[model samples]
Target: MTNQGFPRGLRILTAGEYRHVFEHASFRIHGKGLLALATPNDLGHVRVGLVFSKKNVRRAVDRNRLKRLTRESVRLRQQWLPSVDIVVLSRKGVHEIDSETLARQLHGMWRRLEKDVKRQPEHQQ
Candidate 1:
């Protein structure tokens, strides 16, 4: 459970992984394109996943940009986050919003999510 670099081996991408996060994880919506879900992982660092579906955003460039912004937002705030599996999903509105606004919304969302996570009972291994 070492804290590997972001996007190296720390993202939840598989179907099974998303299923587990949705079923067992706790989440909060931060903004139109920003949602955060947290699940207990044996790994001792926060792992992030970005979901920018083609259905939500048609262009590959837009999708990649959104994912990049999401990743950067999380990375910049990594120090404040707990060690958990975190997933960030992008909605249609994400493409229309500017990066500064998105980042601010993400920060606010993370803060609220952090509070909620702290209130949950510790996960059983």
Candidate 2:
């Protein structure tokens, strides 16, 4: 898993890591059917976590599809992203959208998250 892919190192692997982002996120970038909460991290690269509930996506297949779409989007955009931890939450209607649209939405959220986080004061960074 190089920097070019979604390596283990780039994932928010533990409950505590996810908790920190949820508790202290400085930027909340919302997209259609998605919400991304992000905060600066001490690590020198971006990390991501997904929260696609079965209650929202309804089926295991749909949930897996959403996760795949999100991970693929994150993997493709990770290089230029600022060092931060992000938790992405999915809404009920996510399964209705096509993969391309969902990917575009996720990409836009990442771009916005990158811009907003970089613009924050040094303390937040």
Candidate 3:
């Protein structure tokens, strides 16, 4: 899947999508941030979106930095992740972390998400 820049496309925007992420998806937290994901039924490719609010990170620069870091992290790990629409929300600590640290944390989070998905029972036809 290609990297659909964070806010440009039809992503998890509504309350319903957010609720689905919170209720149905499995999550994993890391030092840099938290990743919440749900695998879509379609057997296509993966797509990702980032949620770095100005409220959480006051400065525009900081928000953009965090989004860039998250996008890069997701791009690098895209191959391993399942075909799903993943939404990544940044925590306060993400602003305090460096890019390298963020990358590491993201890698760990990705692995955990994958494990969580694997543990779920496969669908029966």
Best candidate, TM-score: 2
The candidate with the higher TM-score, 1 or 2, is 2
- Residue pairs that clash (backbone atoms under 3 angstroms), model 1: none
Residue-by-residue lDDT tens digits, candidate 1, 43-122 = 77677877888988888998888888778877777767777787787777678888788778888887877887788788
The all-Cα superposition gives candidate 3 an RMSD in Å to the true structure of: 3.8
Cα RMSD of all models vs. native, in order, equals 3.1, 1.7, 3.8
Query: Regarding TM-score, does 1 or 3 come out ahead?
Result: 1
lDDT of each: 0.75, 0.88, 0.65
Q: Model 1 TM-score?
A: 0.82
- Could you give candidate 3's per-residue lDDT for residues 12-100 as a string of tens digits? 55767666656656444444455455545354555666677776777889888877777777666666776666778766656877778
lDDT for position 22 in model 3: 61
Looking at model 1, which ten-residue stretch has the lowest summed lDDT? 1-10
User: What is the Cα-based lDDT of residue 23 in candidate 1?
Assistant: 82
Q: Which residue pairs come into collision in candidate 3?
A: none
Off by over 4 Å in 3: 1-23, 28-31, 39-43
- lDDT per residue as tens, model 2, 1-125: 55576779999999999999999988999888889998888888989999999888898988899999898888887887889898999987988999989988888888888788768888745
